[model samples]
Target chain A: MFFQILDILGTIAFAISGVLIALNKKMDPFGVLIIAFVTAVGGGSLRDVLIGIQPVSWMTNMTYVYVIFGATVFAVLFRNKLNYLRKSLFLFDTIGIGLYTVVGIEKGIVADLHPIICISLGTMTACFGGVIRDILCNEIPVIFRKEIYATACILGGLTYFLLREFMSDTNFVFVIAGIIVIVVRLLAVKFRISLPSLYKDKP
Target chain B: MFFQILDILGTIAFAISGVLIALNKKMDPFGVLIIAFVTAVGGGSLRDVLIGIQPVSWMTNMTYVYVIFGATVFAVLFRNKLNYLRKSLFLFDTIGIGLYTVVGIEKGIVADLHPIICISLGTMTACFGGVIRDILCNEIPVIFRKEIYATACILGGLTYFLLREFMSDTNFVFVIAGIIVIVVRLLAVKFRISLPSLYKDKP
Candidate 1:
């Protein structure tokens, strides 16, 4: 029940973020809605597909579709007021990634994948929605160029495996790992930490 | 047996195209190989996932991986000669889309999806490899902006259903539909046909 609530909140946060980006790009209403939908579900959908899950999670559950739709409409209606809520939105977004990363790791473990692959899946689940959004918007994925986004997920995934060696309580492990992801991202952003540039000089 | 051969050819074509684009972007060899791999299998992987096919075709079959790897190496080695082979490359790409679109439609039919959804699956399978490639390279998908690419796939998918109504031979229907996609693309390129711009003024 707690995870479900977090999932919904994550969906709302992702949908609103998508709305902000789409509106900034001057997309029409339909485009904005589509972007919001993809951003909310794209990462999880990708994870489900990779592991051979049928129909995907969102298709089986109507809650995500409704949440994304409601969030899109709400964000669009009060887009101007959103500037004031940036910090709140950022917090929600960070929490969303933390939850998503752990969720993905759990799914991978259930599928019996290797630990390395699980870590990759966790990072992908937390990051690929924004990647898809950036691709649609004709920009490089921000995670690929800057930000400690995927790195935090990777670290959290490592923490999950490392903590599991000594802990029998899976739920406790999940919470700690998720908290690690959230805390790492928060610290990274607060300190303005970013990935080092790949290029010798900016192209 | 025939479809297998065609699939390999398509993989090769897609991989080579990916290498070309990655080279143009001055990406490292590792990046180029990753792009080629995605461009070769990304579309079909997407289609399989949507329809709930387990392990996806590529994961179960190593043929695609080998073909893409070989194609990438061959394209990189003969980069200079690729210009002379542009027409040949274009032909292969057209054939690749033709095969991919039909393959996707067949998968959708097996899954008992609606005809409209099947058509969409076909278009996605035929075009999303390039979409992913473009995304990884940080550009708008060429198909979304211009090109009669997905249009050809959609028309071919329609042809598949339409022909199935009158024909008892499934192989014949596949051939005709694939030909339609190939022919439409060939004509579009020859005539420089494109989707009309959605924007009233250039942004």
Candidate 2:
């Protein structure tokens, strides 16, 4: 129940991030809605597709649609009031990643996929929405450029698996692991941590 | 044999389109490469995911990677001289859509999925890459906007299935249907044809 609440909050956070970027780009309202919707639901869409869920999550769940709509309106109208948007965007984005990582891993476990695939799914579910957001904003995806974006999620997912092995209390494991992801991401941003470019032939 | 050639041409055309957009966006060499890859392979990725293909198309075939690589290099070097890009792009993108419509439908048929899902896959395979490209370029997808994009492919797919049921000459049917998609898309662009906007929700 706590996780679900946090998950909705994360979705709202991501949606706000997307809408703010769209506003920065001076997109139309329809385009802004799309940006919010995609950013909020894109990662989970990929996860749902891979897990063979028909109708897609956003299609099946009206709650996500409402969250994105509400977030968009809030972000657009309260832009000045949310003066810390630039300062707090990363934090909200990181929180979303942490929540998504936990949910992704749990979903993968439920699907009975291999541990390796589960970790990959967790990382993907955590990072891909932001990736989609950055891409749609005509910028390189944050994860591909800054390894820290994905690194934090991977570490959290790994910790999740380890904790789940010993700590039978699932919610506790999720919360602690989520904190690990949020901390790692915040630290990475605070310290400007990133990966070295490997551009010998990558381009 | 024809489908193989068409697929290769479609990939090159799509990669070239991506390179053009990357150039317009003033992307770096790595950005160009990444966008090129995504534009060329994204539709197929969505198709594979939705249709539940194991390993995915690009993952299973290294040749697709080579095609994208070669095309990206060609596009970057010759972009200045490609005076006929707009028309050529429309042509090849249309051809890719037509071929993938058939390919996706066939795959779905083999998998014994419902006809509705198969049609959805076909449309996805034909249109989703361009959607990704436009989204990455910070625009609502061209397909979703105007000029008979997905609509053309969907119409062509319907024609192909109808022709397959009624016509005995498979090769002739394929050629005729491919031509119809290409011609429809060309005429749409030539005549400024487009779909009505569904974006008129409450502002």
Candidate 3:
């Protein structure tokens, strides 16, 4: 029940973020909805596809679609009122990633994938939606540019595996791992932490 | 026998295109190979995933990896000479899209999808590899811009269904549909045709 609530909250937060970006880009209504849908479900869709799951998670579950639609509509109707909620939006986004990372890692484990691959799946699940949104909006993905976003997910995945060796209680492991992701991400943003660029110019 | 040759040729063409872009971006060797791999199989991977196919096409087929590796090595070593073969590259790219579209449509048909969805699948299969490449390279996707690229695939898909009504030979229909896609794409580029941008600024 707790996880389910966190999942819905995360979906709503992600969808709203997508809607805001689409509106800022001056996209049409159809484009706005598409962006919101992709942002809310894109990561899990990619993970499911990679793991060979059929029809994807969203196609099998209609709740995600409805939630995205509602969030998009709400965002568009209350655009003016959203400005003051930046802090809350950030909080939701952080919490969403944290929960999503643990869920992703668990899914990868169920599939019996390698630990590194599981970590990658977790990171992609939490971050690739923003990557897709930025691509569609014709901008460099914010995560790829200079953010500790994916790194936090990676660290969280590692935490989950490490804790698994010590505790057999699944729920306890999940909560602690999720909290680690949230704290790490929040700290990174607070301190302006970033990964170094790999780009290079000609000799 | 004929389709096998076309498939290999298309993979090589797509891999080369990716290598050229990665080189232009001045990415590292690993990055170059990553781009090449994604460009060669990303579209088909996406199509298979959407249709509920597991393990994706590339993971099960090692041939694609080998082809991409060979193409990347050849492209990087012979980068300067490649500039003079722009005409050949263009021809290969056109033929690649044509073949890929037909294959994508066939996959969709086998999966028992609606005709419209099949056409979309075909267009996505033929074009989305480049879209992925552009996104990774941090540029506006060339297709989403003014290019006549995806339009050609859609037309080819339409032609395939239309030809199927009159012809009983599956191979004949495939050949004709592929040719239509190739000719349309070639003519569009030859005449500098483009779709108008939907963007509109406030007065």
- Clash count of each predicted structure: 0, 0, 0
The candidates' DockQ values read 0.19, 0.11, 0.17
What lDDT would candidate 1 get against the real structure?
A: 0.87
lDDT of 3 by residue, A79-196 (tens): 8899888888888888889987887888898999998898888888899999888878887788876779889999988998888899999789889988999999999999988776
Candidate 2 per-residue lDDT over residues A132-156, each given as its tens digit: 7777777756554434777787789
lDDT values, one for every candidate: 0.87, 0.77, 0.85
Off by over 4 Å in 1: B1-37, B40-44, B50-52, B57-131, B138-203
Per-residue C-alpha lDDT of model 1 across residues A1-203, encoded as one tens digit per residue: 98899878878998999999999999999999999988888898888888887688899999999899999999999999999999989988998999999989988898877776677678778888987898888876666555678889989999999999999998999999999999999999999986554345653
Off by over 4 Å in 3: A1-44, A47-52, A57-131, A138-203, B200-203
What is the i-RMS of every prediction?
4.6, 6.0, 4.8
Who wins the DockQ comparison? Answer: 1
lDDT value, residue A143 of candidate 1 = 63
TM-score of predicted chain B versus true chain B for each candidate: 0.95, 0.87, 0.95
Off by over 4 Å in 2: A85-89, A199-203, B1-44, B49-109, B112-203
Q: Give the clashing pairs for model 1.
A: none
Ranking by TM-score: 1, 3, 2
Q: How do the predictions measure up, each by TM-score?
A: 0.62, 0.57, 0.61
Clashing pairs in model 2, backbone N/Cα/C closer than 3 A: none
Kindly report which residue pairs in candidate 3 clash with one another. Answer: none
Candidate 2 per-residue lDDT over residues B114-133, each given as its tens digit: 76777677778778887887
